[model samples]
Target: MSYYDVDAILTDAQKVPCTFELTVPGLGHLEGNPGAEVKEGTKLELPLWLAQMLAITPAGTKPGMITLDLPDSLSQKVTNALRADPRTVELRSLAPHFFNLGTRMLDLFEEEELSDLLTESFKLRAKELADHAHNPRGALGEGAEFLQGLDENERRLFRATHEGAKAVRAWLVGMQKK
Candidate 1:
């Protein structure tokens, strides 16, 4: 079933679950048009990892914190839905403020179609960062240089990711005020 077709809760109010159709292929579907409303029953593909993420089983999924990497242009209706529902608080830990810098950078690009040049560059740089992180066994600020090349407007949006992280942390902290 698609994300839009997803049943938040089964008849007994249990969390509805579905298995992924494909492993590495992953789920991806359009969210209506960019500037218009999507009719009901619109198909929204759900990736395999997401199915595991929402799965009721463990040892099948990565325990503790996990991040679902998504494209910048993507809009997950289920994320919003789950976020709104009190029963789905388990997801909040992995959802908000997980540092989706990929989407943030793409948003900074403002591209209707991502060019091959930019895509290739990002891949190479990402590999470099990955290698650096792996070798150092510590951390990598490798993205800082490429990120620095972006204009102020882009940096503003990029920084917003960290800001969102801070806000989520603060919100959780304040919730303890109860």
Candidate 2:
């Protein structure tokens, strides 16, 4: 019931490589570009750290200076669905990874309707999770079923919320007995 599953989200996200480019000069060659110069229009695939660095760099902020291509087939679909109608997309189906990853790259993704839609969806789901947690004595309802079917990130969020609720209940019980 770790309230913050950022570590798990990061761990899963680290395995994936994101696409990025350098716009400004002087950033120099990165680990991925061995013996190669990193300049404008130079595209490279590296880990999230490198991509994140390039994204936040002073030069990176410049338009066309840095372009990030985050690949999430499902997210793209969800974004489209949300644009069509917020109700069309299932909140449970949206990956927490996308929410976390997307936030870091918001500058790049802000233009897409999906970013805002996903943000709204994530916040709603989080509140829903907290509500479910409060009912510790309740049976495994639709929420539990939904959680069971979630991907790693979604499951992690559910587990953390559920655990937090359990702990609070246990603490309350202990206090009552004292």
Candidate 3:
């Protein structure tokens, strides 16, 4: 997650559910009530950057100003779907930076199940992605649906794998000519 990485920036801009733990003055614009104070216990979907800061920053003796919850993308429903069939889940529909957001969330919350599930899902999906990438006709054929569901990182991996295979073939052809 480099400072200049566009994907990282976009991932940080993704919204996550948050509940205000303490009422503060003049912060209602976040909830679309400009010039009004955000009341305690108000729930809002805030960008990951803002929500993370507010959720971790301490106030006096209290822990923080807001409590952060998992975004809808990482909800129990999505988890169950991934557990059932990682290859079938449309990760891009959930979030463009699904894995990246999951990594960031894991940094904040400790969930062994989520951690293991994400790792296993990625491994499974990557194997499938590699297979599709290596097959020239796969993208346009039955694999199209799965390819379309790839998130940012997976898409990059697919492209790299596809291109690498192409390059290898080209090299082999040149060798044959020689």
The TM-score measured for candidate 2 stands at 0.50
Error of 2 at 80 (Å): 2.6
In candidate 3, residue 144 scores what lDDT? Answer: 97
Candidate 2: 10-residue stretch with minimal lDDT: 11-20
What lDDT does the true structure give each of the candidates?
A: 0.36, 0.55, 0.95
Model 1 over residues 80-160: C-alpha lDDT tens digits?
A: 533344222222133322123223324434554433333443344444434433333322364444443432323344456
TM-score of each: 0.23, 0.50, 0.96
Weakest ten-residue segment in model 1 by summed lDDT: 8-17
- Top candidate on lDDT is 3
The clash number for model 2 is 0
Q: Work out candidate 3's RMSD over C-alphas.
A: 1.5
Query: Residue 87 of model 2: what lDDT?
Result: 32
lDDT of 2 by residue, 1-178 (tens): 2556665446335423343354444444553545555666655555555555545545544543345576453356656765665433454444435555555555545556556666676666566656766674442675665444344555577678889878888999999999
* Cα lDDT of model 3 by residue, 92-141, tens digit: 99999999999999999998899999999999999999999999698789
Positional deviation of 15 in candidate 1, in angstroms?
A: 56
Give the CA lDDT, 0 to 100, for residue 131 in model 2: 70
